[model samples]
Target: MKKHIFLFAIVCITQFIYSQNDNIPEKKTQKGFGKIDFLSIKMPETTIPNESNMGFTGIHYNLMMNDWSYAGLGIYGAVTGERGGFFTLGINAGIKKYFTNNFYLDTGFHFGGGGGKSAPDGGGAFILPHFNLGYNFKDLSINSGWSYVNFFDGGEIKGHQLNVGLEIPLDFSYADYDVAENDYSFDGLQKSNWNVNSKKSSLMLHLNNLEIKGDDTNKNVQNFGRATIRLAGFEIASYLSKNWFTFVKFDGAYDGIKAGYMDVFLGGGYHLPFNKNRTNILAKFGVGAGGGGGVDSQGGFLIYPDISIEQKIFDAFFISVNKGYVMSPNSHFYTSSYGLGLKYYVERNGIISDENSFSEGIFKGIEVITKQDLYFNAKRDGEPTEDMHQISVQINFDLNKNLYIAGQTSFANFGNAGAYAEGIVGLGMQTNPFINDKTSFFAQVLGGAAGGGDISTGEGFIVKPSAGFNYQLNNTLSLRTAAGYVKAKGGDLSSPFINLGIKYNLSFLKMN
Candidate 1:
């Protein structure tokens, strides 16, 4: 695939850059979490429905316990021009045998799930057995291997890919490091850390789907919000303590009949830990407003219980998945939704710190971000893509170093097609991509109401989910580009967006 070639080229480019940094010392550590971004392609001679030329791009993270063992997880998006595309989230365990300081071989097995309309191969569920050799640079590496994929639909695919990515440091081999080598599993990192109270406070921002169940009010539901394909909103969770948490969740989905849907919840819950604290079960209940079909379709109450499983893949970074049934009994409403979220924990006892990263003082305090976007594929069926320009401002309320809530507002111009505007509030997480502290990785999903734009068909609510990196131009300003998906209510029109923006990080006062 063309994409794969582009990905391989990136590796060459990065290698060139890494070599120029020869003045820097070689970073050979025993234990660390390296966050790597990869792109690859597969060419299967035996053409299957969608296996001809497949290109995949995603972020991969590895928890290397030492030079000889590691665990890996990646969330990737794949596409085949002739066979559609899908989102694949996978995890693998492997061992590394270094023949020399810079050369090593790795072999592993991967298991994961795939879904979305793009995943035509029966949800794209599969397992992969693979092996490859890699050469490590000071902070970069290259690995190429062959992988055999076995799909649930009786489809088998054979392919090979090369991964070129930067490393994310998880250096527990430094000062005050107390974990015994025996304590850290050599089989690769555990799926999760499993300690609930170990960290006092936690913050999470996520994208979720609302699948309304029951056949009684299918039509009415359509009149209320998107019944299916709810590329909807986000939720912000503030885990106050190990067993207690609070939430601010927003939902903006389409109502088949009209531009409808807007809901916000403020609630809290209790958590219980089992399985030696490797997993947690939580119950959260919230009361919020679901106003859309005018002022009268407002003031709704929601009660839902979610039992979630949390596992640590590397350090404070973890993954959570849960299923919930929601109902506004008084409103005669019943719906069920499933969610997958990535969470980072900030402890209550002390400030979160990464000695391997840039000084914590480089980040923190009130921050503001502004961006301009050009949205494509904004029109409905049989129509050419539309170019819409939008500008927005966001105010980030700092709660701590690694976590915060971002509130944003935007104005969009669709030319004669119509105009649109929105106000968004959501949670966000930030981390440095390298030790320099000049480059940052930010991921967030924002939910808000979109009105006044392209109102000829009536105004609808909108939800946008995006991720991107930032390059600090200086201490106060940075440049960023983000990519996201935007879905609107009532109108089946949605588009993928690329945003270019600038940000200002200000330290108004000091924090102890």
Candidate 2:
């Protein structure tokens, strides 16, 4: 397995190099739009053993690759029945056929990794395939479909059901990375239809210490006396105004509890600048659902409210300190937290009040990729090691010609441990195009949190080093493959993994 992994890394580099040559394939800058789907599905049976009949709430963002097809990300959570905290998130792609301007048939499938609330998610793998008929209106589309939900590992949950959805239009802007790199004018960006308030955005990393409050009477786990839970995660925020912004955060446990404790939050905030625009005060609030690790938050509804102070430490970089409280109103968990963070501004292509003004993400290249991972000899503390499958998304930002920074999140989709997840960030280096611009290769090292699904990821701290090949499909898309090893800190988890992915190149720039 180790030798194969090493060979795979070499092949990845070879493919990536060949894919980037000037002679391979060329395409012009293109414009595309996407849609967001708010949907629901209900199983056909009752709760528990009859885990059928449970209703799930879902959301998907599909980016149009063309008029009739899209690739996107989706998430679903149990809203009705006894499994309130059961959820899954992963990658999806779909195709639509239009019989008329207003009528269409939609088909798609979602592969996600997440399980909670003692739900029978054998190792956290979930699959849903749907077929629907719809009528499109000027503003939105409505559809109903037949869906098949399968948790394909050691899980016993399977169902056929009817699903309904609402589709709303979303718009964004992009340009070819290679084109923009050679001739950036920052004009014509206004020509694309954008829907956001501004192009300004920030990526933040945070380390937090939480003091557990409340009793275990309402939670899935019991008897904790003022424990301290340490967590780390990342946040991505986009400004709606100069002082207002919306954000999403994901955090995982590293201490004070068994590994696998995690949460994801969405909210908005306001920033007040002072000290000659170098210092600011910010207030934020987030609400979301979470449960896992032995410290189960039954019914899984949580809220976080906080205030912080930020100071600009360098150009495009800021440092912050915050104090906050966390509570699960519907469950039995509460905590007070103190945190420190580092934030970097990134320019995005979006709607701006002043078209001529620049946002922070000026001259950069970005890559967003969706991946499917297969891990060999995956293990649980007391069980035999087995193979596991996971779904993940990785975002990369070019720091220089041969180097890039990357962040990734992954969830187990087909393994013995359901509700298993991971989040990591690190740096990578790529070789120049080889094999006639058809392929290239690269390698990276990442460190972050992992735990859940009974995996022995001690304290949820881990490091992964990987190497891969990139096969350029076109100017803006590529096929990627990587092989890596994951080793947990102070834990008993070690595995070799391979992943296959689709990559999309994004350039947040304009040409003359």
Q: Which candidate is the best by TM-score?
A: 2
Best by lDDT: 2
Q: What is the C-alpha RMSD of each candidate to the true structure, in Å?
A: 25.2, 10.6
Candidate 2: count of backbone clashes, pairs at least 3 residues apart or interchain: 32
Worst 10 residues of 1 by lDDT: 173-182
Model 2 CA deviation exceeding 4 Å by range: 1-55, 78-85, 96-105, 131-146, 162-166, 179-198, 215-222, 350-362, 510-512
The CA lDDT of each predicted structure is: 0.52, 0.73
Per-residue lDDT tens digits for candidate 2, residues 268-326, read: 99989888768889899987755566664545557889999989999768998999987
Q: Any runs in candidate 1 off by more than 4 Å, and if so which?
A: 1-199, 203-207, 213-233, 251-262, 291-305, 327-329, 348-368, 372-502, 506-512
Cα lDDT tens digits, model 1, 1-512, are 99999999999987765553432212122365544334344534343444445544445556675567877565443322222213344565788788998887877776654422212233235566667777778666667666655545323333455554344444421111111011222111111222112224455545455565555555446554546423245555655555778776554433322333344555788878776555666677775434332312212334565666777767656687877755554544456767777665543212232211211111125566767666775653333445665556676756565566776655442322222345566778777346575787888887655543233223456678888888878755789889988876555557788988777565321112
Which residue window of length 10 is worst by lDDT in model 2?
A: 20-29
